[model samples]
Target: MYQYTPFDRQFVHARAAQFRDQLERNLAGTLGDDEFRALRLQNGWYIQRHAPMLRVAVPYGELNSAQLRAMADIARKHDRGYTHFTTRQNVQYNWIPLPQAADVMDKLAAVDMHGIQTSGNCIRNITSDALAGVAADEAIDPRPYCEIMRQWSTLHPEFAHLPRKFKIAVSGATEDRAATGWHDIGLVLRKNEAGEIGFQVRVGGGMGRTPIIGSVISEFVPWQQILVFIEAVVRVYNRYGRRDNAYKARIKILVKAEGQKFFDAVAVEFKNILERDLDGSAHLITQAEFDRVNACFVRPAGVVAQPEVAAAADLPLAYRRWLERNVHAHQVAGYRAVTLSVKRAGQAPGDVTDAQMDQAADLADVYSCGELRVTHDQNLLLPWVKAADLPALYEAAKAAGYATPNIGLLTDMIACPGGDFCALANARSIPVAAEITERFDDLDEVFDLGDIDLHISGCINSCGHHHSGHIGVLGVDKDGTEWYQLTLAGSDGSNHAPTAVTGKVIGPSFAASEVVDAIEAILDVYRAERTAGEKFIDAVKRLGLEPFKAAANARRTATARHSDTAEA
Candidate 1:
């Protein structure tokens, strides 16, 4: 994890103080709500359906034990006793009071954390693979580059007030775990034939009311010029991206509308930026600066390669299952990356209570070099777990309710704080997520189902990344009644599905009560039709959506008939 430098600390503290003044002015009626909206949004404060929400940025999903503890304290003292982890790898407090928002920001700054650029039409939190440094298949560690981008994007004067929110994701691994193809700017760290580090840049992918996969703008941009190239891209969008209509304001819409014209314009802009000697090389990332950032990402002091240990056949069944599902292979010998599942019955997916957060921090201190990574799938990752400590960690995690042993299983779904907290949400996502989790509680059945990305969103905003799920459920409203639309065969560009594509809707929307049954019906089709050893997503692709669609509609029809009978 990158340690905050003296300047970084000063900047965050100063920003927090500034926010306090702005908030006070708003409260005293000196600043109207309209005038203060942008100010508060830049600092990650939002007036949601029921209360003020604050989203704390976890840049590239990196966090230290102290930061986690600070967030836990805030949860305990300011907001509700829990916080929600978002798909973007940020943290949100749904019930924080507006008056105390400034105080929360101050506390966050004390721990080298804050909510800067977490909302508003700016570059949001930069995300990367949770297993970035330790992944066995990595081409180059992306953490350093992610940090570089983070520093460049944070409070950037030129790009702060874009037409719409922009997102960027970086992936260096052979597999696309970071969903780079779905970001507004997706960067894949790679080396050319000469073995020099650079990036494969994809631009304009996003999800909302419109879902579009990013187009490959440049196959390779030298690592040193990444910042400049990205600047050109954003600059082009800033000049031409629609601002009059919020719905069509995303870079994706601009890219889609312009196509080759957009790509050509960006190319010209990139050339001009260099030709004009803009900033006189100030924006260029020199090797010294790269080295400085890269040094922070090196293996923590106590972490080193260890001798391999043989697997024991006598391991407990539960522990073995947990290892199978939650433990990921590490690049270093005799180490593993373990996921602590926050998705379980009763609670919403990604919701971690204060006690749970504190416990996670303690687990990080004891087992992971006092560092934790928030996963894109709304889970916490211990990235430096020793293979030898698997049993002990499993026991501790189980006791802490973080050992659900369902990493990619159906229950380990991603869901946003829906109508329950988000005013923009058309329906509640929590109940839908909870129902599906309860329906799939049987581990045996879940494992047999195998590696399903079940993502739910309360609306079209895609905060929960529903468009990327193999089984996507989108909450909709029908004449004031809550309904859900199901989609099949969406891919987040993971190893399972290398191409990022939006899921196709199965059929007409289902009533909220029929959603779980609809999901069950879809999976039933998979189980019946899939070939041996095929994953749910692969099965969906092999057999077209017709079978799943028919099965889901059948369930919906049966539910309607039953309701009609009861009414009669």
Candidate 2:
């Protein structure tokens, strides 16, 4: 787990004080509403529909037991007891009072945490693979690099007010677990023929109204020049990227307008300019600095071998099923990665109460080194548990309602905060999510479905990662009513390709429960007709949408035949 340095702790404390003073002035009528609005955003406070929302940076999704416990306390004390984990890997408290926002920051600073750079037109928290350093395939840990980027980007004076918010993702492997292709700048640690590690850099890929996969602007960025190259790219974007139209502001638009060849040439020119200014403006990265960052993430000593986990071999058939489904690879020989599922049957997806958060921290304390990682899919991950204690860990997770074992199954869904809470949504996404999970009660049925990703977004911005889901559902508002638009074959996987629109609006704003039934109707047809070894997405691609859409819209049979399973 990461411990805050004295300087880190003090920095947050100072920021909180700064925000507190600003708030006092604003409320006392010394500061205008517009002035205070900008200042409050600088401190991660947002005025949403119902109340102020506070986004707390988790710092590459790594935190300690103490930090999480503090989060639970802060939520219960200053805001709602429920916190929402976003796809960006930060937690948002939706019902914070504006007057108490700075106080919330003060509470966070006490635990060496802050909400800085979590919003506004600034660099957001740098993200990496959630399962970094512990996947079955080996790569250098990406967290240390992500942390370095976080430090460099935070409050960066030069790029503080860019044309738009910029996002960067780093991956440590061939597989794009961090959505590297959909970020302003993406780095893949790579080894050259001489075994020298550097970075394979891509720029200009991002998502919004216009989604694009980044192109490789540099095949090989020397190890020492990583940060310098990134700076050059951002500099170019800051100067030339769109500021006229919000939709056109992302670097992707710049790349699209410039053409790939032109974009690559300009980037190369920028890289050359930086190299010439190495001693002046460019401080090339060094092995020592990398080592200094890497030191922060070193694993704890004496990772105990859990020989007693052999008891798992003698467990009931269902326990064995859970052990196989939820457990993942660990870099350490004796340890295993544990993903605590929040997707219990018939529950809202990606939600955790203050109590649940506390329990998660407690689980981390006893089994691992009081550490946790939040995956993009909204599950808590204990990354360094010993294998021999699997049975005990499993039981503990079950007792605490954290053991659903449906990490990537059909029930594992990504849904946005829709009409229930979000001001922007026209339809509710949570109940639809709950409906789908309950409908797929049989694990064997879902396992056979194989690697289905269902992502729902209440609107076009695709906050739920609908562009990445194998089955993408978007809520559209037509004349003050709700409607759903479905897309098939989309993915956020290693070689993900965006889904093609199925083009069948099954219902002109179907009722919440009816949508789930529509999806079930479609799945039934897939199961009945799919070729052996074909996944749902694969079967859809192999056969196309006419059949699936028809089955879902089979209204005559919908009532008696599981109507709630219709297109959730």
Candidate 3:
């Protein structure tokens, strides 16, 4: 984790104080609601459906045990007894009051955290792989680069307010767990023919009403010039991006409208910035600075590998199941990364109780390296757990309600805080997610179903990244009733896939009550149609939507016939 320096501390505290003053004035009638809207939004305070929601940034999804404990404290003291982890690796308190917003900011600043740049139409949090440094297939640790961008992007004067909210993601591994294809700017680190490491820059990729995979503008950019290139991309969007309509203001719209011309313009702008040194800050990012940032993330030590214990045949079936689902391979031989599943049965997909957060911090201290990484899938990662201690860790996790043994299964769905919290949402996402989890609670059945990425979003803002799911469900409002539109064969980031594809709509939308049935029908079709050893997404791609649609309609017809027969 990046430690906050004195200057960083001062900057955050000062910002918190400034916001406190702004809030006080607004309460005192010096500032109106309209006047304070932008200020509140930039600070991550949203006037949501029922109350104010505060989104606290977890930079690159990295936080130490102390910070986790602080978050728990905030959750316990202020809002409800739980907090919601977002798809972008941030945490939100949905029940916060307007008067206590500044107080929450002060608490976050106390732990070297803040809500700055978390919302509004500016560059949001720079996210990367949850297992960035620990992943076995990593080309390089992407955290250093992510941190550099985090420092550069936060409250950037040149891009304080873009036409729309922008996101950037970086991937260090062959497996793109960071969902690089769906970001405004996606950087994949790779070595050139000469073995010099650089970035493959993809721009204008985003998910919303108009979802599109980004275009590769630059094949390879040297490490030192990354900031300059990013600036150039944002500058082009700022200059030409649509501002007349909020829906058309995103960089993806500009990219789609202009085609290759946008890429060409970015190249020209990048060259101009590089040649003229438009910002003197670009020169400050030399190898020494990179090294300095990299040095902060030291590899964990004192790991003792107990091969016998790890390989024990006498291990409990529960522990083995958890090992298979929750544990992941690590870059270091003796260590493993463990994902704590927050998508347990009968709960909101990403909701975690304050007590659970405290317990997680304690477990991190005991088994992990006293740090945790928040996954894009709305889970937490203990990135440096010894393989030998996994059994004990699993036991502890189970007791703390962290061990669900459903990491990548159908039950482990990605969802957004929808109509329950957001004013923009058309339907409630929590109930939908809970119903799905309850319907597919059997671990054996989920395992048998195999590697299905199910995602649900309340609306078309795509906050849940539904377009990336193998089975995507988007809630819609039609004639005052909640309905769900289904999409199939979508994927996020993957080196295995031919290309990352946005899910296509299957057919008509289903009523809220029929969603689970529709999902089950789709799964039944998959089980019957899939070839041996085929993953769910691959099967969907191979077989297409026709089979699934037929099965879904069949389920509906069967249910209607059964109802008629019972009535008779």
Distance (Å) between predicted and true CA of 17, model 2?
Answer: 1.2
Task: Encode model 2's per-residue lDDT on 96-145: one tens digit a residue.
Answer: 87788777888889878899988778778887777787776647677777
Clash list (residue pairs), candidate 1: none
Can you list the residue pairs that collide in candidate 3? none
Encode model 1's per-residue lDDT on 1-568: one tens digit a residue: 7989999999999999999999999999999999999999999998998889999999889899999999999999998899999989899999988999999999999999989999999989999999999999998999999999999999899999999999999999999999999999999999999999899999999988899999999999999999999999999999999999999999999999999999999999999888888558547899999999999988999788899898898988888899899999999999999999998777898999999999999999999989899999999999999999988898899999999888988898999988888999999999998888778889999999989998999999988888999989898988888999999899899977888989999889988889999999999999998898999998888889999999999998999999999999
Candidates in order have lDDT scores of: 0.92, 0.77, 0.88
TM-score of 2: 0.92
172 Cα displacement, candidate 1 (Å): 0.6
Model 3, residue 262: what's the lDDT? Answer: 91
- For model 2, give the RMSD to the true fold: 3.5
| Best-to-worst lDDT order | 1, 3, 2
My TM-score estimates for the predictions, one after another, are: 0.99, 0.92, 0.97
- The best-first sequence of candidates by TM-score reads 1, 3, 2
- When 2 and 3 are scored with lDDT, the better candidate is 3
Candidate with better lDDT, 1 vs 2: 1
